[model samples]
Target chain A: MSLEKQIAISPAGELAAKLNSAQLPVDACYQCKKCSSGCPLTFAMDLLPDQVIRLALLGQEEQVLGAVTPWVCSSCETCTTRCPNGIDIAGVMDWLKEEALRRGYSIPQVQISRFHQSFLETVRLGGGRLSEPLLLGLYSLRSGKTLEKLKSGELKDELLLGWELVRRGRLKPKLPKKLKGAGEIAAFFAKSER
Target chain B: MKVSYYPGCSLEETAIDYAESIAAVAPLLDLELAELEDWNCCGASAAHSINHTLALDLSARNLLIARQAGLDLVVPCALCFNRLKVAEKALPVPQENKGKTQPPVKVWDLLDYLTQPEFLKSLAGKVVRPLAGLKAVCYYGCLAARPPKVTDKEAYENPGNMEALLRALGAEPLDWSYKTDCCGAGLALARPDIIDTLVKRLYDRALAAGAECFVVSCQMCQANLDLPQKRIAKKAGRDYYLPVLYFTELIGLALAHPEVDKWLARHLVDPRPLLKKLGALSAFA
Candidate 1:
């Protein structure tokens, strides 16, 4: 068995690229670990916010891409605001989420990427954003597990939430009757994907 | 003056008092609330935790909906206001990756909309009886002040703007420790155990600092302090209660409406005792 771990990039080169590119201050990360110290959900993460930034700066892209922190970061920005050096760790985490997905890395615990993608797909399909049908679809998909959780025996709970929105006049059934650049924006996201 | 009103999800349900208060005070301020039609949840804690872009998109869509209505938004809920402001900050920033998607709208906070000079001037003249002697502790929870990127224009730790607004309404605003602390928001839903601790910590600090009662701008915060605090205290085996008033409710009382009873009567925690102590509660049978 091989005892050595694979490296993502040579540390020196990665640090140089990060220094030039990342808006967060690499030197200001004071190793105090305040970010990890304050995270409310740290128990759920394999890599802490401070550690992800540290690894990214260290050119450990393989380690970062494989880690669970990026997917779990709520972008609460609690870690960033509490950082003594004012580093935007949450922004870095957001960057990492996009990067990890681009690299085809998956997080098992986060486990809801497909559901979220469905929401975006709904937006793309409408030529703009619409929440009610999109969320109903998302909820129905989620209701599979939610039903099992309901020993309380109320599957209509989800439907009731939707109906409540309707009663308040907050939810609507129709998409924008017409939009000028709807086709253009959808085309833009589609082409950008390529 | 016209303002786009974004009464976040809780307003229609648990925090209806806040909606009532906003409605009561809006006419007095000569402010017109053009409600944003077909608005969705701002995705405060859940969507943000589960999916980042979806959260931003949810908040941004509300903003764009307001923009489509040709009005900038006003939110009475601090969490919704903060989420909208954060989404606004996130939307304009160019992402690094070329092929990745982003949310398609910009967002703004209620404070951001209300603080505009002309709007503030309109609110100034509507003060009828001015809460002369009440010393209010302006409680801005973590949601309203975090993410310095979103709160760049407003000072996060020192949110004296609420104080300034209170002062303008002729009430003295107290500087207190629990001003920006968590009010155990949605934790009351999924994690009631943790809320007992967070709520007590918040109320204790304000009581110690000599605050008459808490004045808040968030429905979630108001719910925790107003209705749920008694249960929280009971869970902790402590007997303590503090009156939490919406900022709009204070302004409403100061204006001396005939309908003040309806508004004050709606509070799960009665504010009449505190208002009478402040010499502002009036002759309403």
Candidate 2:
């Protein structure tokens, strides 16, 4: 066999072990497409939910971690709910997101990851609570979508929606109110520094 | 009855109307929502997606505060409710404080707490200005009940809690297929295209059910369903002027709360004209 075929056929088994660490019953998924059927975000996903699990079961760590399916997963829990074998597919998706980050996989769904990073950054900096204006500003800058839109002269779409929200007192453009338990929240962040 | 209330971060701004609507109708049901002082965000989907332990720790901080009050906690946001409950479940007691006699705290979504048997009885009695002709579908976007294991929700698939509550207030709750379906709330900002798709599906389904509006419990659901109407309309070649509302706002309207008008005004697609048409507006308004 050629080197490419040998590598593709080899079963590393580490990815499956990591997934099953939480008693996820990763081995028990019997190719039931119930998860795939119920998943709402599959239209945007490169691999279906069931297909992602199938690859993981086959120890295809590169294919599983690098897939767009995990990043686009809305964490809606539709697959988890329908899984007859009781695999936490949504939870697994979350794990895959975390794992992808840890392994430095080039995320195809870059904006999605940036949005999540913005959320965590907002909570940490705001002393616990997230500030909406700050979140949008951070996400806009971090994702580079704002700059892209600005260059394309297409930023008006988001601006119009934001202005509408502002009219209704929905999106406030102020600093978040600092909460009392900053020390502990900071400590939690420090201890779990990823 | 008194309960600790965690309004969560959204209530502070985007969904302030939901908070006020709940407050507007709280007194009629004799419900005292003692705010959980100095509580923080549950870290929401962001923390959970990246770090599970941090997510649990964030909500655990709030759970600790709730445990101090020794009261059942009521969370107004569906996402917060799920995050807090997940926190309580994961770290039932603070890791350091394990084996100590800490008072257990039961976390409830605001909708769940309001629809409890005792509360429901009081709510039924307080429906003075009934929303007789108002037609809206109860849209329970995911997180309030999902995964079954974390939420422990018996009625995840076809939850009728909101419908039952709306009926007590004399409004017709329309039946729709996507009641418990995902609205792509997690992808609201990151991928507007996907959110528009998911939300448009909901709008189409709700309108096809002969409904005039979307009654939502989650603020994310309300925002997703409400904010994208113009864009969705342009793309679909149809106008969906469906007014998305907080179920509490409808309750406030049915109970004749004065702030109902103010709450209705905050929504992007105004439900006031719909209310006027249905004769569901407060007399003072």
TM-score of each: 0.66, 0.95
Clashing pairs in 2: none
lDDT of 2 by residue, B1-285 (tens): 899999989898889898889887887788899999899889899998988779889988888889888899998888898898777777746433556665567888889888988877878898888888788899998899987788889999999999999899888998888999999887888888898788888888888999999899999998888888888898889877899999898888888877788888888888888888777774855
**The 10-residue segment with the lowest total lDDT in model 1 chain A:** A1-10
Show where candidate 2 strays beyond 4 Å.
A1-8, A151-153, B93-103, B282-285
- Residue B159's C-alpha lDDT in candidate 2? 96
Reference contacts preserved by each model: 0.08, 0.88
**Top lDDT model:** 2
Q: How well does candidate 1 match the true structure, expressed as C-alpha RMSD?
A: 7.8
Please give the distance, in angstroms, between residue B184's alpha carbon in candidate 1 and its true position after superposition.
Answer: 4.0
Report how far off residue B152 is in candidate 1 (Å). 3.3
